[model samples]
Target: MSAPHGINPNIPHSARVYDYWLGGKDNFEADRRVAEQTMAAVPGIRESARNNRAFLGRAVRHLSRLGVRQFLDLGTGIPSQGNTHEVAQAEAPESRVVYVDNDPIVMAHARALLTSTPEGRTAYLEADVREPRTILEHPDTLATLDFTQPIALVMVAILMHISDADDPEGLVKAYAQALPAGSYLVLSHLTLDLIDKRTADDYVAATSSQAMHRTPRTGERISRYFDGFDLLEPGLVAVSKWRETPLFPDEPAWMYAGVGRKR
Candidate 1:
């Protein structure tokens, strides 16, 4: 099959799989197969995905209420309801947001669908997170945000896909170093802590695409990734417990989330 927006329709993209998990139809059979296989291995995975999305909304709203008007959302999956701009602009009409993603499909859909309030602004940048310098140097990001002020760097349920060899920690530190003091790092990542090793390996194996490869980190490691920042209350907790009333009080999202102010 030919690719759309330069995206191979046959390859299972991580973002597409996530979209399917969140009950969106912007995925192909390849994505659905991997999502279902992972779901078969782990129950309530779809619900967990929803819970993660809810956490994103809560985090954005919470930060926006605190007067952080600029946002740089990396690895922003398929544009869905309650997106970062929608959540932030709702809190303040003048909020500015820049969504970045490596996936062409996401960029295509986002360019066509995501828009901001007339008083606010939203822009899309197609770039890899590994190149933090490129993102920080992008003209659109600089134009949309004022570096003198605080901005939120959002990485929801995305960093786990970065391989250890890629030096994920160092990459995060680069982004952190670029932001001014008072800027926040908002992140949610998958973990292997709750599930058994076999299940973790099986889940990783089941999703066989190199582009979709994931390395589930432990909670402690994920916490350490926020080294340059001071965590807020209930730091590095499950996504569902992050500053929001839990929709499903009992089920664990098996993901850790935190919002830390750069020191």
Candidate 2:
């Protein structure tokens, strides 16, 4: 009922750290420091972030073109160029979007800046992905979306922050179950599949202070999230290889991304 906690500049948040990595200036000193440390652990981290964001844009545009007009974007981080709604509405002006995030700073900024096309609607909810029901059943979401229709559930780069103990697969299922048949689940996750074990371990250790954990899953483990759905082409490939741009190669990025249609 009450508003969530406000931004604590003292603590480093994963979203703000990611914003800093993408060359955005919205991060605090703590966030920047941690981001730098993580980057040091994995040299390609900043480029990985940029590529992951580009993947998000491409996926949203593809889904929008497919007639998926409603989007539930979780872990909606600090607004940057080419966000979900921006890409979706660019293709279909009437696409409705519901951006959800636990971060109060993201909530504040989203409220002030994540605007939608006049024909469409956009709403922000201060909610956590772990609490999928709260987000799916929230009044704001109920008013903006029709669950009976095909909706796109986007969980990009955020699941890595969730530890295995949090049951990421279960959380994904919970949200996916709320959507109707023909809906899609779009995700891009961090994996150590490409890097050395020591480097991955160091990267995980660097994020420990912020309650962030990385699960470097194999392609098989990552595929579990789409258990009940039919995967799109090039199923469960590295983020860089998922319908990639001309610049991306067959080689894997540090992240894995895929989309599945609920059958």
Q: Which candidate is the best by TM-score?
A: 1
Model 2 regions more than 4 Å off:
1-5, 201-211, 246-252
- Tens-digit lDDT track for model 2 on 110-190? 999999999899999988889988998999999999998999999998887787899999999999889999999999888
Clashing pairs in 1: none
Candidate 2 clashing pairs, residues 3+ apart or interchain: none
Instruction: TM-score each candidate.
Output: 0.94, 0.92
Q: Could you tell me the lDDT of residue 36 within candidate 1?
A: 84
Q: Which ten residues in a row have the lowest lDDT in candidate 1?
A: 244-253
- Model 2 superposed RMSD (Cα): 3.2
